[model samples]
Target chain A: SAVISQKPSRDICQRGTSLTIQCQVDSQVTMMFWYRQQPGQSLTLIATANQGSEATYESGFVIDKFPISRPNLTFSTLTVSNMSPEDSSIYLCSVEQTGGNNEQFFGPGTRLTVL
Target chain B: LAKTTQPISMDSYEGQEVNITCSHNNIATNDYITWYQQFPSQGPRFIIQGYKTKVTNEVASLFIPADRKSSTLSLPRVSLSDTAVYYCLVGGPPGAGSYQLTFGKGTKLSVIP
Candidate 1:
């Protein structure tokens, strides 16, 4: 298991502004992903942070709004651009180590409240 | 698209066993079933993973039937700490393609005294 941490554990931002969440893994990871969990709702996969390239986003999410960067194996960032009240959710980053069968280890989520 | 289905909630007494079932009708050949436990204000934690038959760990046991369309997560000797949400995840093994996981609405287990 890897030790994963997210910066700015909770934040309140104004609508139309942007906030960037950072995820740092203790060791190198094979796959890094960002997820969103709304109030009283299940998690939704936002994008897969691919190292040295653009992130692969899931449907209903776009790169223009949620731009991600994975510079190396142990670090990544997800920036929520032009935030809105609807974007107020808990954002989490997870890592699946190499040779594992998708038993992902997740970071303590960043709670974003857009006012 | 979510790939698994589970119950909405359950209630069990302390010291009793609780079994939560999940259904994956369109599970692919390479897909595996994994269970996760989530507490309030915390991220989901890996509980168990099974491809077929049964898989057991210190925390819980997973029972997968022959058809592989459904699986059961058995928690022996429930406690107040076990009161949380449990998710059933199904996805292909880590590989070049088909590695991302899709989560469904998990079952919320409430433990009674």
Candidate 2:
């Protein structure tokens, strides 16, 4: 497991605004994922970011809305574009480990509030 | 990913063992049962995972039956700090496959003091 950190742990934004959350892993990992957790709801996969490639987004999510960047193996960013009240949620990044149970370790998460 | 069904919520006392059962009858052969614990305002942390039989680590245990249709996550002598949302997930990138997972509504465990 690696130590993952997210910048701007939380933020308050107005409708139509955009916020970019940064995720930094202490060690390099092959798989980095971005997940969104709405209030009182389970986490949903937003996209998979692999270095040197475009992000692969899950259904109900698009690159235009949640743009992702994976410039290197240890860092990535997710930007919530044109935010709305319904976009208020917690954004987290996870890194898949190599050995053991192959568990995915997550960052503390960025709490976004769109008013 | 196999769809999972688990209790919405449960209440227990401190120092008591807690078991959360998740149903995944359609689980595929390659799918593994994994459990995650999420505290308020934080991302989920991996608890345990198993394919069959039982697996125990320092934090928790994962029990899977022969049918692979269901699994249980057992936490020993839970305390107030154990009160959190527990999620049961099924699936993983099967061998250079996709890096995606599906999460279902988890069981909320409230450990009372």
Candidate 3:
């Protein structure tokens, strides 16, 4: 199990502004992912962060809008650019343990509200 | 990624056993079933994962049918704190081309006192 933490537990931003959320893991993880959960909706994977390389994004999500950075094995960041009201959601970071059990552990998440 | 289908909501009383079932008709041979619990305003927490038959842990037990098309997550003597949204996830083996983890609409368990 990994202890994950996210910065800015909750934030309120204006439209067109960008917010960067940070995710820190206690142990080095090979596979890291970002997810979004809107109100009354299930989680949706935003991207998979690969160490030292570009993050692999899911369909319907673009890097220009949601850029990710994974400089090391234990840390990553996701930036939401040109935010709008539709982008208001809870952003979470998760890490898959590098062993047989592929269960993913998640962070508390950063709640973003765009006005 | 195999799409999952589960109940939208459920009601249970404290101290009762709760079972939430999920269906994944297109589950692959290497796909594993996993469950997660999420409280309001918090990230989803891992509960259990299993490939076939039954797997028991300290908190929950997962029962997978022989066909691997459905799975049930059973929580014993659930308490009020256990009231949360439970998610069922299916994914193929790591590094496999079809190994994409997708979160489906989960079952919301409301445990009453």
Candidate 4:
């Protein structure tokens, strides 16, 4: 198990503003991912943050809206750009262990509310 | 990714064993069955994973038959704190671009006293 932490546990932001959420892991991990959970909905994969390269965004999500940066193995950031009211959701950062079989450790999450 | 089907909710009493079955009719040969538990406003926690037969840990047990079409997650001696949403996922491990974990609505298990 990995101990993961995220900054800005909860935040309130105005529409059209941008917020970057930080995710820090206790140890180095191979792959990091970002997800979104809307109100009363299941979790959706936002992107895969790859080290030393551009993040891979899932369908229905684009880099312009949600840009991610993974500078190192233990840390990454996801910036919700040009936020809107519908962008209010819980953002989570997760890491998959090198040898683990489909197991992922998640951060506490950043709860963002756009007004 | 294989699609998973699970019940929307389940009701159980404390100290009773709860079994939640997930059906993945299109499960591939290389795909594995995994379970996760999520609390309110928290990330999902990995419960167990198994390819076939039975796999048990301190927290729960995963039972997969030979057919590989379905699997069961057995929580022994449930408690009130066990009330949460349990998600069942069917996919291969990381490295195969199986990073996207498709989450179903999940079975909301309420352990009543």
TM-score for every candidate vs. truth? 0.97, 0.95, 0.96, 0.96
Candidate 2 residue lDDT tens string, B49-93: 888999999999998989989999999999999999999988863
lDDT by residue (tens digit), candidate 4, B1-113? 78899999999999999999999999999898889999998999999999899999999999999999999999999999999999998888545656537888799999999
* Pick by DockQ: 1 or 3, better one: 1
Model 2 / residue B16 / CA error / Å: 1.2
* Backbone Cα, N, C clashes tallied per candidate: 0, 0, 0, 0
Candidate 4 chain A minimal-lDDT segment of 10 residues: A97-106
Q: Which stretches of candidate 4 lie over 4 Å from their true place?
A: B93-97
- Calculate model 3's interface RMSD in Å: 2.4
Candidate 1 chain A, run of 10 with poorest lDDT: A95-104
C-alpha-based local distance difference test score of model 4: 0.91
List where candidate 3 sits over 4 angstroms from the true fold.
B94-100
DockQ of 1: 0.68
Cα lDDT tens digits for candidate 1, A20-78: 99999999985799999998889999999878778899999999999998999999999
Which candidate model has the greater DockQ, 2 or 3?
Answer: 3
Candidate 4 docking band: medium
Clashing residue pairs in candidate 1, if any? none
Off by over 4 Å in 2: B93-100
List fnat per candidate, in order.
0.65, 0.54, 0.61, 0.59
Candidate 2 global TM-score: 0.95
